[model samples]
Target: MTMFSTIRLRAAAVLASFALALSGCFLSPGKFTSELVFTGPDSFTFSYEGEIFFLGLSKLAQMDAAQAEFTPPECYNQETYESQECSAEELADARANWESGAADRAAEAKKKAEQMAAMMGGIDPSDPKAAEELVKRLKRQKGWERVVHKGDGVFDVSYRVTGTMGHDFMFPLIEGFPATNPFVQTFVRQGGQVRINAPGFATQNPEQAGMGAMMGIGSLAGLAAMRAELDGQGDAMPGIPVIDGTFTVRTTRGMRVLANNTDEGPEPNNTGEALTWRITTRTAQAPTALIALIP
Candidate 1:
């Protein structure tokens, strides 16, 4: 399992505990609490109430991709054969080509991430205005605000999907959090905005029938695992993981609107039609000041 998977398990446990306490359904051994105060030059203050515990982020991008492939049969190609489809000998050649292309993409992503890191430089995390300024910059860049502050633990980031708008927002990490993840989390500001990238999952949501046809080679779970799984294994590969990026804002009240746009997609047919996802996040802390930097 990746460090994130493990953290998710733990975070879930915390939420479970909170749920129990809130319900008064059963007594718990203890109650935990933390206070996050945000202040800004705009004279903003955000305060979080209750025993806040980290909740592992649900990957909206992965979920949407699954939805796109699952609920709509019309969205994907059901054909059994294409040039990409071929005999075992030909499949080998195609696989080699795909792998080469994937490698180039991976190299590019790595370089971009490195360049971003290099631009952040130094900033004191303990500064009183740090969090506020950070949030403001993130909003300006339209980046993610899915952050998990674990006191002295590593800062976990969950970025929003690249293409999602409003509530339809989804997240596809640059790389999904590893089963064993670690980081010296920092924020980067550029061109009056902030940029952030999170780990992502690699997967393919082929038509069920089409996908099942190849399952004899490896299970769906195996194929969806990650790049590490495909390194030396002789199994079919999964699609490259989706990367999510976003702009986020902190609100004085928990209420927030990740305003949906007409450009998002074809509008819903009616109130009952499938709805487009909007990407929005609510932090435990009320935003005291808006920060528009990258994460």
Candidate 2:
């Protein structure tokens, strides 16, 4: 019974949590080139030129509902570990557990949806108007040079920012969004240590991506089933974009990189050292670097 109660939406969580785990739940990158440069310990410049994909209205509108609804685990399945030859009492107990959990699931879903709505200007990405509002909201910000909706929740845009690393930094820091899951995260630690990660760039690694790699979809059948289970139909939704891009980081001399996953590591650049990662649908880990500056 302990295991049965927690199995709600196990396989489906992969698809649903793909974007949901992103925490932002609104925007993720499709294809782009992003870069971060440190002129000095307290100074930096960052830019991203690429596509921002919206998965809520376009690819995963049923995610919340899918998460909320529990499909009964079939016992005696050959492929899955969920079920086996069950006695009548076990079956009855499972049914009772399922029935009891329904109200809990519904309540949790409602609470989560409400919290997301509060953060997102009272609108979730599943709404058609979300795309327009996103563009407008981004345009109102100083860094967003272009914000054009290309249909199906994809946007073509350019962004650039220059600031001091005296404090931490993050990209796609929407005014009304969650801060925990920035596409780009920069943390300034004590003793001039700096850490960075591009959570949105990695497309296909399970460690980084909850769904298909990063935010890339793994299976249409899975999507259809989750959607059908929640939206009452299993038809596939189209126009899901691929993820492809390059990320580069340049640091001035005297900076020592502590950890990273770049080909050939950090190569000598005009300013100092540079790290680069090419992103694709097969790309699993995004760009990450921890550097110690001359203090």
Candidate 3:
């Protein structure tokens, strides 16, 4: 082939690839499957499970508070254990008191459950994924696109994260959905398009000791930190988040790696694009803080 013809063909291929990547940033179906395999130069393969599995895995890593419960006091003391000669009337009274106490506990539990449901916007705590999607939509705006499907409370969306390396990765069709529980969610990313199925949330009943307290605290703290980082980064705006940190963008054949992630305030949002978020990462003490962005 002639040199000019080869050059034209190469240019067309690059343009086509770019368009395909960009188009993947739109909303699509609600329930779908995805498998993303990253093969590196060393034959390294990194596989990601669907969004439901991801959320489930995350839950496994954390603890649930509601399920942890304390053991009831012993039914009998040394004196009671030793003596089996209690009067029939006395035994009957003891049984009556025990039942009354159990009833009271049940009532209190019901009231607490109602209160929690009200606080969560009338959502059931048993559905974690639904809750996660609700929080995401309520908190993060812009990039997400809504898809229309009859009789379905599902949304098709595109979520983009511009890393500190000045590169953007777009997740297309990340569906937002509701389910019985609000904590657990199912998300799928296929061919760059992500779909969300049934998301569920659950709280441990009666609450356990280790998993309940520690996991509850950690999840709260972690989510709070993430929200704060996003809020402070100014990447919440319509511009890309540009940080001076270690960033590596992988392509079909190679990777563009950057270091010294810095978000220069002078950066402005390019309105010509869909949306951008500019963020500056700085180290204060043991934790890192994301500063504001311009434009």
Q: Candidate 2 on 80-189: residue-level lDDT in tens?
A: 54556666776678778877988876786666666556656656765668778878888998889998988876789999989998898888887766664467889999
> In order, what lDDT does every prediction score?
0.25, 0.67, 0.27
Top-TM-score structure, candidate number: 2
Full candidate order by lDDT, most accurate first = 2, 3, 1
Please give the TM-score that candidate 1 achieves against the real structure.
Answer: 0.21
Where does model 3 exceed 4 Å of error? 1-94, 124-216, 219-295
Model 3 per-residue lDDT tens digits across residues 1-295: 0012232332233222222212111111222222222233222111111121122112211222222333222232344343234455655665666566765655654654444444334544445554464546433544333222121223222332222212222233233422222221222222232221111111111123222231231122222233234457542211111111121112232321112132431122222111111211221111111211211
The better candidate by TM-score, 2 or 3, is 2
How far off is residue 265 in model 2, in Å?
0.7
| Two-way TM-score contest, 1 vs 2, winner | 2
Better of 1 and 2 by lDDT: 2
The TM-scores of all predictions, comma-separated, are: 0.21, 0.66, 0.23
| Superposed Cα RMSD, model 3 | 23.4
